[model samples]
Target: MSKNSIQIFDTTLRDGEQVPGCKLNTEQKLRIAKQLDLLGVDVIEAGFPMSSPGDFKSVEAISKLVKNATVCALTRANKKDIEVAAKALKHAKKPRIHTGIGTSDSHIIHKFNTTREKVIERAIEAVSYAKTFVDDVEFYAEDAGRTDNDFLAKVCEAVIEAGATVLNIPDTTGYCLPNEYGAKIKYLVDHVKGIENVIISCHCHNDLGMATANAIAGIQNGARQIECTINGIGERAGNTALEEVVMILKQHSNMNLDTNVNTKLLNYTSQLVQQSMGMYVQPNKAIVGENAFAHSSGIHQDGVIKNRETYEIINPEDVGVSKSSIILTARSGRAALAYRAKNVGYDLTKIELDVLYPEFLKYADTQKEVNDQDLHQLLSSKDNFKKSVNF
Candidate 1:
């Protein structure tokens, strides 16, 4: 409820690790936790303790080393889960136990086979139990996106009274559109009692490709905390990419929200997570993607060559990316070709260049890229490059 700061709760090691084959070892999780601390996240949901012994160890190890952020452990709405989550987070300078239950009728009926009143009761009991071990208790309404508005408000009110310091509204299935998600947060803001005293958070997935949009929308609707992951890795499509959401709040004045993340560490942290998961980042992935700054078009490459800002809204350096890359390809313009050639110490006359371009095209097609060494060899040989000088 603080008007001055927006909290970023990074769930990369917890919910993100739930993605198939994305599980990280304790050392890896600790490495990520250290990085997250440096990145300045308000909280790091280290892992779900009851999932496995490995996960419990990860949460415990991370809890020991995390200094700047509140080290948190996730739990279900049960005492055993809350106790395990508490033990895993016992070593933290600041610890938070994030406990929750499903609130939607669909989840209550199909998932838990319980009634709405029982769902609210379980949520209150979970928070009350978690508060026994940690002063910071965050309660989530799993599948809140599909829950009835009035029932969701009622759940939030009851949980706040039960000592929940933060209320996380998760779009577990990523079913809400941006506007709908925003309205959900706004509704809670208006209706939930003591909502101003407890932090409101967003946990959106990318099933409909709107996770980040929904997260931003939640911010606009007065939610101060965003629960997201690196590269959007999660259960299904993924959660909101923390990099995108942080930068969105940073670069856009319309959403004057701000997070504690050090934008410079984003790319490295992303790579760490990717490497730990044994998955490569898609080339076109935003922010940390290999092609995020790679330009293949003629006009765009030319502009990027002259001024990166002309083609890129974000400075590559802001996300630990070095600079824009002017990649020469079939679509590359003369300016890019010339610039690249010059980097390798070639200064061909327009007339000479016109003759050699054919060979360049042939080589370029065979390889993914044209390098300086190949260009040098072709230009050095007068036998291939020379012609009747007529320009």
Candidate 2:
């Protein structure tokens, strides 16, 4: 587990709160922080302390409460911001001052209106300054996805030399495809000095809906940590989902990466964030979505009844999701009718189920979803009629 460990750096408090109309207060942040710790995240990005006094207080309180995971404060590539961030995290059992600057030309020319050389110098200074207050410092090259690979490598190597413990390469606008992002991480893995000693981290945004894929690509190429948010909540499109990435490692690929996440806590954690943040998750979202394991189609229900493995790649209970329904609809089939019937305590024989499918379809035609009572009533009526005939 130690060798294959994948550090989960959750930024739900910082990035997630940035979503429009989803701001969370200090108490809400503290509650979420305690849960992320209990859920076993390796690091919690409490907030950007320099953003406001409220943010600073939230980070300070969260830092005081977190017992296991390192509590981190986000900062920009300036001594003032890094100092503010460092002060906010001073009470953390394990404090980290995260400081970084934009590396891509777009950010340099437009956002900061500066030169690339100046950005690199600022990055080195920020990481060095942060290191003075906290032994654990993480340096992110914002928009690294669009930065020149050679310059990105140089920036990463300089930060590592400046006492930074982690190098975060972020797909800031979610621009790069998976293959390209993987190549970027692989290049750093191969080229950066003492790169093996520093944890190579991936932070991907989901503007192209490729954040999870990009993060996974980073892992395959030697990244050991994923900087993500709960339910994929973050600025704009969002960040990689912590639960999605963790369960992907546990259930699907041979990635063999381990996170401290208890597989069963995913749904609860997701719901908590959604409610506290006032953001509703799309029903079709992955991992903790309401419909992730649900089936309503005829062919899919039949296949699933024959073998769950035919339809479901991961078990529902594995992520704290209850068994999803083969929701009765006009598209349902005999297998689904039988499956639903048995769940309500009616052990219908294949022959009995064969007869009930059409009746279930009639209900499906009118109803959005079939109820357990209605299915039982339909089956019970058929049983009574058969017994009367025998009598």
Candidate 3:
């Protein structure tokens, strides 16, 4: 991989499916997994093989089906989970076992009921065991967002020494600010021994809606791989969105960071996941949302009609969208009205537009949106509008 290239590790099939009511059958999982591989993701976290028989089958099937991307299976820091994950991934051209234990004090004491020393031992044991099965092993310090930097550095160094090829520092609870998360990654980069040999990965959650920011910060500091999901689907609020981070890196070329993702397939992949999982993306959601390219406000519409870059940072076609939508609402201006009017074959002159503007506003005010049919009716309903029509 190039120094500036970021590895996109998509866990959509696993973490994304964790959302309540977003479950997918094996067939659906296969469909989405194929799309993800085609979308140029570096790794696909197929599923947690030990979670259930169905998940194991899905992971096994995906391992065989995926040709290019490394098929990864998630596991806790244990031999049994690592064994199951390895069995499921035996057919993969390139397989990865992702295993780790929680390192945060909250998780160590409250969740694992263990001391930090024991937690580090389990982390090392899991990575070493996983290494025996797959050459590419990723160790995650679960809830590393809150893990002490000194202790987190120790865990990372131990895993790297234990043959872990990747270290995933996850903001499991989505609690860190971007600066803090970046500093944590920097601390690991500076403090951990032999860290230069393995890739640093970021796995941030969206409980506080800062997952994207935190993931960006991680990469800026030292992380190379970003674990994300399509449409940001996951447990609780969700994980960092795949599309958002991909586009952010692309748009900010000064950062000198890019990903393998095919920029155009973002919307199509998002729709595929949404349909397969039946999870609805909010209209205003970033990147692949319905309104991402839609212009509704009058000032915005006018600016966009003149030049798309005036209001849109991204071209609609770049992400598989056909065109930008110039939605006509009461807030729409004369320029937007004339632009929409021209699309429906009106081609109204300035004088004609002036005459029709009041009537259009009257109709637009009564309705949420004024479409082509509405404009046709509005123009034909009155003799004055009929006279004003260029036709």
Cα-based lDDT for every prediction: 0.87, 0.89, 0.94
TM-score per candidate: 0.94, 0.94, 0.98
TM-score winner: 3
TM-score for candidate 1, please give it: 0.94
1 against 2, candidate with superior TM-score: 1
Tens-digit lDDT string for candidate 1 (1-391): 3584789999988888887887777877888889889998999999888999998888888888988899888888999999998888888999999999998989999999989989988988899889899899999999999999999999999999999999999999999999999999999999998998999999999999999999889988888899999888888899999999888877885655677789999999989888888877799998889999999898998888888889898999999988788787877777787888777766667877787777778777888777777777667765644453221
Q: Is candidate 1 or candidate 3 better by lDDT?
A: 3
Q: Clashing residue pairs, candidate 2?
A: none
Of the two candidates 1 and 3, the one with more favorable TM-score, higher being better, is 3
User: Which residue segments of model 2 deviate by more than 4 Å?
Assistant: 1-3, 349-355, 376-391
Kindly list the per-residue Cα lDDT of model 3 for residues 1-391, writing each as its tens digit. Answer: 7889999999999999988998899999999999999999999999999999999999999999999999999999988999999999999999999999999999999998999999989988999999898899999999999999999999998899999999999999999999999999999999999988999999999999999999999999999999999999999999999999999999999999999899899999999999998888999999888999999898998889888999899988889999999999999999999998889988888987888899889888899999999988876777866776765
Provide backbone clash counts, one per model.
0, 0, 0
Candidate 1 Cα errors over 4 Å, as ranges: 1-4, 348-352, 382-391
Models sorted by lDDT, best on top: 3, 2, 1
Residue 87's C-alpha lDDT in candidate 2?
A: 82
